[model samples]
Target: MDHRFEIFLACAPGLEAALASEAKGMGFGPLRPMAGGIAFDGTWRDVWRANLVLRGPARVLARIGGFPAVHLAQLDKRARRFAWGDVLRADQPVRVEATSLRSRIYHEGAIRGRIERAITEELGSPVADDGVRLLVRIEENLVSFSIDTSGGPLHRRGFKQAVGKAPMRETLAALFLRECGYRGTEPVLDPMCGSGTFVIEAAEIACGLAPGRARKFDFERLSGFDPQAWAQMKADAAPHPCDLRFYGSDRDAGAVRMATANAERAGVDHLARFECRSATAIERPDGPAGLVMINPPYGERIGKPGPLYGLHRDVGAALMERFRGWRVGVITTEAGLARATGLPFLPAGRPVAHGSLRVRLYQTGPL
Candidate 1:
C-alpha cells in the first residue's frame, strides 16, 4: 500500500506563511495554507520527519481516513469499517474526540461515544480516557478522522522545565525569529529572555541541531514504526560550528539561572550565554550587529499601562543610544505600548491569538 496520507501542520494564528515557508524549505510537497495551518500530502516517513525537524509548527496531524456521515448511525457504521489496524495497534489504548460544525450530527457527545464503541468493538483496542487522541471533525454533514502525530504540542521539546512569568513558547519564538529575518547566521539577543526561548532556539538553528532531537514523539507508539529507520534518521543530524553566539539577559536572577540550565539541557550552552540584567542596563555584545528581539511585559499579563510605558520608553532609549545598526523585533499586545518605544517601527504584522489576548510583532530594519 502507498500509505500516503494528508498531513496538517498546525501553528499559531498569523504564522501560516512562515510555517509554510519552513515546510517548503524542508521539501514538503504541494503546500497549501489554510486558516490556522498548512496542509500537505506525504507518507508516514514525512510525518516522522516533520515532527523531528520542523521548528515552527505547533503540532503535526495525519488525516488517517474519513467518509460522509450525516447521522450518528451512519457515523458508527463508517467508523467500524475504518482501517484502524493499519495505524493503531489493537493492544494499545486510544481516545476519540469529536467536533461538529454546521452539520446534521451536532451532538458531540453522541458522536464521541459512537466512534469510541466502534473502534473498541472492531479493532479490539482498549479505550482510555487519556492517551493517543483521534480527532473527528464533522462539518457540513462530512466527517473526517485524524490522529495527533505529536502527543503533546511540538513546543514541549522536553528540555526546559522551569519557566518564568508569561514564557513564550518555543514554536512561537522560532516563527517570530524567522519573521525577523533570522537565518541562523547572525547573533540573536532577547532582553527579557523568559526561559531563554529565543536565544536557545537561535543557537540550535545556528548549530544545525534538530528541534526534536532530544525529545520523544507520539508516532513511536503507532503501528508500523521502524525503530532502526528512526535511529538512522536521528543519527544523521550533524551539528555545525557556529561562529556567532546568542545572548539572553533578564532582571530576575532566578530566571537567568533557569535559562542557563535550560540551555545546558538543550546541548547548546556552548553557543548561548545568559546573564542577569535589566533591559535598560543591557549593552550590546562585542560582535557584528545582529537582531534584538524582546517579548516584554504587557498589560494583559503584567503591570498596568502606566508603568509599562516608562519601561518601554527606557528600553527604546537604551537600544537607540547604545545599539546602532541592529534590527529589532518587539512582541506586544498594545500598539500604544509599541508606540511608547519611540523606535522607528515599520508596519506591524497580523495580530496572533496568544492565550486570551492578541499580540503582534513590530519590526524595524536597522536602528
Candidate 2:
C-alpha cells in the first residue's frame, strides 16, 4: 500500500535552500522548508530513494501524524488511536522523543514520560534502551511520529570505523562537495584531510556508489516492509566507474591512518590515496585541476582564534601559490579567520549550525 507519508529532511541551518534545490533536481515534488528541516510528501519507497540519494539532508524522517493535543490524557488517547502495530513489532523495542514549542508540555522529560507510559500501558510493550527498534518525533503539539528508515543516521555509512579529531560529518561533506560543484570529472584534493571525508565522498560520487548500500535500516524491522524488495533495490543500485580520482593529505600520521582505514572500508580505496603531509606541502594531482575543499580547525572551545587565523592564512597562501585555476571551498566557524585566508571569497553565505558552532562556507577560484 503506497500510503501517504510525510518525509522530514534534517539539514544544517541556512542550507535549506540548497537542500530544497537538490530535492527538486532529484524530482521530489514541492519541498517546503521549515525550521531545522524540510517536509515532502511521498511513499515508503520514496523515503528509501531519499536516504540513498540525498547528500544535503542529515536525516530523512517520515512524519506519520501531526494531531493536536492539549493534555496528557488526550495525547495518550490519540497515540493509542493510531495504527502503531502496523509499523512496530510487538516483541521489539521502540523509543519516543518529544519537544514542545509554545505548548503546555514544557518539560521534555515529562512529555517523554507520558508517551512512554501510554505506549507501554496501551500497547503492552516495554521500551528498550540499547536495542531501540523504532524512533518517533513529536513536535509543536503535533505528534509527527516516524520510524527511522535509515539506521543510525545515514552519515554513519558504516565505512568510517575510524576517524580523526574534528572530522566533518559524511552528510555535510557530501553537501559541501555538491555546493562546490564537484561532479568528480576532475581530480579532487583535501589538503587538511582529517579522516578524509571530502575526498572519500567525492570518490563515491565519481564511482556512482550508493552511500547507504552497505548499511541496514530500521524499516527492515517493520511489519509491512519487504526485505526481498529492499535487497533487489540495493542490487539494482551498484557502483559504476568514472574518470576522476580522489586524494587527501594530513600533517598528522594518525589522521592519515584513519583516512586510509575509512577509505578502505568504503570500498573505494582503489580510487583514492591518503598521505601524511601538511597543507604547505600540498600539490595538484597528476591530472587537471578540480575542486579543493577544506574544513580547517577553529579553536572556539578554547576561546582562542589567533592560531586559527594563521592556519587560514597559510592555507590561503599555499592555494594561491600552487593551485592556480583551481576552485576552492572552505568551511570555518569564525568569519575573521576565513578572511585571513585572503582568497577573493564572494560575500559570505549564511552561517549554518554545525554541532555546537555555526559554520559558513566560502568559495573562490584561483586567479
Candidate 3:
C-alpha cells in the first residue's frame, strides 16, 4: 500500500490564496495554490486530518496515480494494471468520470467506459451511479486519477440545517473570514446573518473545535481504512474553552431562531448568540471591537440593488455611528451596491464565484 498521497483542497476560484493561507496556518503544506484549489503532498493520515480540520475547502481529493495513455485501449490496460485493491474495495460499486483536455483521446465517454470495464473485470467492482466518484483527467496524452475523499462536501459540516435566502456556503464564509483577518481571537457579528454560518464557523474556530467533528465523510468507506485509528483521531479533537462570544443579528425573528438553532447544533451555542434586530437598530456590544462581516442581498437573489441602496446606506450609517473601531467586510455582487454602503471600503479581493454570479469581499480598516 502506497501511503503517500497528494491532497487537493477544492475551494472557490478566487479564494485560492485564502485557502492556501489557512493551509499554511495549519501547517498542512509547503503549499501550492492552483486555479480552483490547492494541493499538498502527505500521508493518508494527513488526508484524514485535512478532511477533519480544514474549514475552507468544498471537498478534499486524494490523487492516487497516473500514466500516459494516448488511446482508449492504453487507458483500459493501464487503469486495470494500476493499483485498485489498495484503496477501493472489490465488492463496492464505483463511479468513473473522465475529462479529456488537449489529448489524443478526445472521447470522454469511451475513456469512462474503458476505465469502468477495467474496474469491473479486473478489480471486480461494479460501476454504479451512486458509488464513490473517481475523477479521471487526460491532458495532452497523460491521464491522472484522483478519488473524491471528502465525500458530499466539506461545507455541509453536518450542522447547519437552516438556511435563509442567498445563504453563504460554510467554505466561502471561512475563506472570507480569513480574508478579513479573523483568526478566532475576537468576536464576529453579521447583521444580515443568513442561517448563522459565519457566527458558527467563528465560534468553532475560537473554541478550537474541528469543523468536521459532527459530520461523516466518504473516506470512511475506502479500503485499508482503520476505523479505530480514525475514531482515535477524532477523539483527540478536544475543544479548548474560549471566552469571546460570536454574535449575529437579523431583522426577522424567524432568522434569529434559525441562527440560534444552528449554533446549538454546532455545539457552539455557549459561544455564539443571535438576536432579532435590524442593522440600524444594532448597538455595539460591550466588548473590544472585532470584525463585522455581512453578506447582504445583492440583487442576484432577492431583487435589484436599486432598492438596496438605502439599506446599504443604513448599514453603513449604523456602523459609522455606533460601531466605531470595528473592521468590516461586505460581500455582494454589485460594486455599486458595495459602494452604496458609504463606508470607507478599501481595495476588495478578486470576485469569487458564489453561484451563477460572482461576488467580491469589500473590506475596511478599523472605524
Candidate 4:
C-alpha cells in the first residue's frame, strides 16, 4: 500500500501565492497555500520532481503528524505516543526544532527539550547536531510535526564551490528566473551575475536536469527507502544537451572567475558563457527574444542608501538603452531605488524575504 505523503515547499514570505500558481501550472494537484509555504499531496515521485523542477521552493518538508494538545503533559504524551519508530532510526541522530504561537505551552526550549527526551530516552536514540535526521514542529495549542526530507536545504546543490561577494542564493535565483518567465528556451542574461548561479541554473533547467541529481537527500537514509527505485529515478533524470541558453557578466573580475568556476563544477560550462564586463556590454544572441534578470546592489547589502538611488537610475538607463525588446525582472527592497529606475513597473507578485529585508520583484515589457 502506498503511504499518504504531505509535501510542503517552504518559501519566502508573501510569495506562497506565486509558488502555488507555478505549481498548479506545472500540473501539481491540490496545491494549498499556507503561511510561508504551499502544501500538496504526492508520492515519492512527486517529491523527487518538486526538488528537481521547482524554482521557488526554499526547502521541502514531509509532514509526519499533527495532533491537538492543550498542555505540556498532553504534548509530551501525544508526541511520545506518535509513531516515531516508523520514520526515525534508533541509531540515527536527530534534532527537534519547535515554534509556538498562542499556545498553552509557550516555552519553545521546554517543548524542544521534552520532545528530545521522549525520543532519546524512550526510543533509545540520541540527539545529533550533524549527520542525523531532524524533527520540525509548529505548535499552536496543537502540534504539527515533520521530518526534514531535503537534508541540508535544497539550495546547497553541491556544485557551487566558489562564490563571489554578496552572491545570490540558488533558490532565490531560480525563483527570479521563473518570475521573468524564463522557460529556459532562449538565452538568459545576468549582467550583474554574481557567481553565475542564475546562468548555471538556467542551463540545467533547459536541459531537463534535476537540481538534486548530484546531491544526497535525508530520505535516502530513512528506514524502508527503496534504493533501486531511487537509482532508476536518478538515472532517468540525467542531464542532456539541448541548447546553449545562458550568459552572465560582472565588472568584478573576481565575480566572473567565481561564476566560471561554479559553472564548471555544475558540469554546464559548455552551456554558459561568463565574462568580466559591465552591464552596458550586455547583448542578446542570435535567437528568439529572451529574458534578462538582475539583482543589483541594494543598500542593505552595499553602500549608503544615498548613492544607491543613482546607481539604480544608471542601471535603468543601461537596460532601457541596451535591452529594448527583452523581458526584464529586477529585485530590490528600496522603493526609492525602484522608482529611480524609471522602468514601468508591473507587479509579478508580493514582497518576499531576502534575508531580513522584505523585497519585491518589479518587471517590465518585451522592450
**lDDT top scorer:** 1
Report lDDT per candidate.
0.91, 0.78, 0.89, 0.79
Q: Model 4, 114: alpha-carbon shift in Å?
A: 2.5
Error of 2 at 81 (Å): 2.2
Cα displacement (angstroms), candidate 3, residue 57, comes to 0.7
- Residue by residue across 1-367, what tens digits does model 1's lDDT show? 2578899999988999989888998899799889899999999999999999999999999999889998888998888898888988887789989999999999999999998898899988889975678999999999988999898899999888999888889999999999999989999999999899999999998888899997888788789989999898888866788888999999999999999999999998988999999999999999899999999999888778789999999999999998999999999999999999999999999998777888999999989
Better of 1 and 2 by lDDT: 1
Q: Please list the residue runs of candidate 2 whose C-alpha ends up more than 4 Å from where it truly belongs after superposition.
A: 104-111, 131-142, 301-304
Candidate 2: the clashing residue pairs are: none
Model 4, residue 320: displacement in angstroms?
A: 2.5
* Candidate 1 accuracy as TM-score: 0.98
Q: What is the lDDT of residue 1 in candidate 2?
A: 39
TM-score of each: 0.98, 0.91, 0.98, 0.92
- Cα lDDT, model 3, residue 77: 81
Off by over 4 Å in 3: none
* Number of colliding residue pairs in each model: 0, 0, 0, 2
Q: Give the per-residue lDDT digits (tens) of candidate 2, residues 1-367.
A: 3997778888887877777777887788677889877888998888888887776777777766557877777877777777777666666667766667777656767767776776677666677774443444445666566666665777888898887676789988877777777766777899989888999999998887888888877766655777777778788778787767788999989999999999999888998898998887898777788889888888863336777788788889988888898889989887888889889897777788877888889988654
